[model samples]
Target: MPLPDLLVSAIALVRDRRVLMVTARGRDVHYMPGGKIDPGETAAQAAAREAFEEIALDLDPDDLVELFEVVTQAHGEPDGRLVRMRVFRAETDASPSASAEVGALHWVTTADLDRCPPAGAEVLRRLAASGTID
Candidate 1:
């Protein structure tokens, strides 16, 4: 049988020296502020929706700058599953707070990557390499 398809859209809302991260309820690994792409929704649309749903921050789809697209083993999911991630950078001055499925929210830097999931760590590493974050 084919592997279960898992497609997600995430956002890195960077400001100052930190990027926004969220921990799902009952989960320890923090991830970028976004979630799965719903049927009929564009990846950018999903990214914006997930950001607002999880962090209570409304982000315009047009304001999101596409950053990276990576396919990797799914984290916290069944074996043999894969995740296709479309990561974006949203420009906003709004503060993020825990909401919806988010249990805790944090603004993290490169030093805090140990607490992040693998995909999230990859995102941060790329951002740092691109000089987008310190």
Candidate 2:
């Protein structure tokens, strides 16, 4: 049987027509800053916590606006495994740097979608279609 879908939360921090993306240590594909939701934590809270943990960004859960959700094949996992991502868009003035599991930080436009996982690429495409990013 296929494994259960991975549940995750992600944040979109866009500025100047670009959105923030991150690559985990030793990984080449990039995605939004986020991870699995801990037990008893809301998706928004998980997203905020992941942002801080992965990229050293301080995000308030209350400030996150639900942008959209994506269901796609889970990157780095078995072929049948899927990921359900709850994505949010929020404004942050603080600078983000690579930290924790994050290997690097990048500000990417739609042109860089191919560098992301399926779910991440879908998020970028939607953001671009909505004019949220270039």
Candidate 3:
């Protein structure tokens, strides 16, 4: 059986060769620092909002460059839910600290991508293959 699709926005904050990943409190799996778009919110707006909520990284919505969008099984959701993630890339030097539901923030290089969730794994793969992030 297939899950109903979910729409969400995700942001990739890349600096040097590392991208930022966050883990929710009490959770072990890592994910990109973004979340579901609110009603009437655009993808970029949601990405910016989620970034600030999760990591305290204040980003301009206009600064986000769309990297890609993918549909994948929602990692922690019920069995019948899928996520359509719109990923964006931005350059930021501000340090990211855990906030809101985020427990910790980790800088993930190409070698550390395996620590991420499925959607994050796909984002990393696409970024790596495109040479957007090493």
Ranking by lDDT: 2, 1, 3
Best of the candidates, lDDT? 2
Candidate 1 structure lDDT: 0.86
When 1 and 2 are scored with lDDT, the better candidate is 2
User: In model 2, where do residues sit more than 4 Å from their true spots?
Assistant: none
Q: In model 1, which range of ten residues has the least summed lDDT?
A: 70-79
lDDT of 2 by residue, 12-125 (tens): 999998999999899889899999999999999999999999989888999999999999999889998999999999798899989968889999998998899999999999
Residue 125 alpha-carbon offset, candidate 1, angstroms: 0.8
lDDT of each: 0.86, 0.93, 0.85
Task: Please name the candidate that would achieve the greatest TM-score relative to the true structure.
Answer: 2
Report the error of model 2 at residue 54, Å: 0.8
**TM-score per candidate, chains pooled:** 0.92, 0.95, 0.89
What is the overall TM-score of model 3 with all chains considered together?
0.89
Q: In model 1, how large is the Cα lDDT of residue 74?
A: 84
Q: What's the lDDT for residue 76 in model 3? A: 78
Please give me the total number of clashing residue pairs in predicted model 2. Answer: 0
Q: Number of clashing residue pairs in every model? A: 0, 0, 0
Kindly state the number of residue pairs that clash in model 1.
Answer: 0
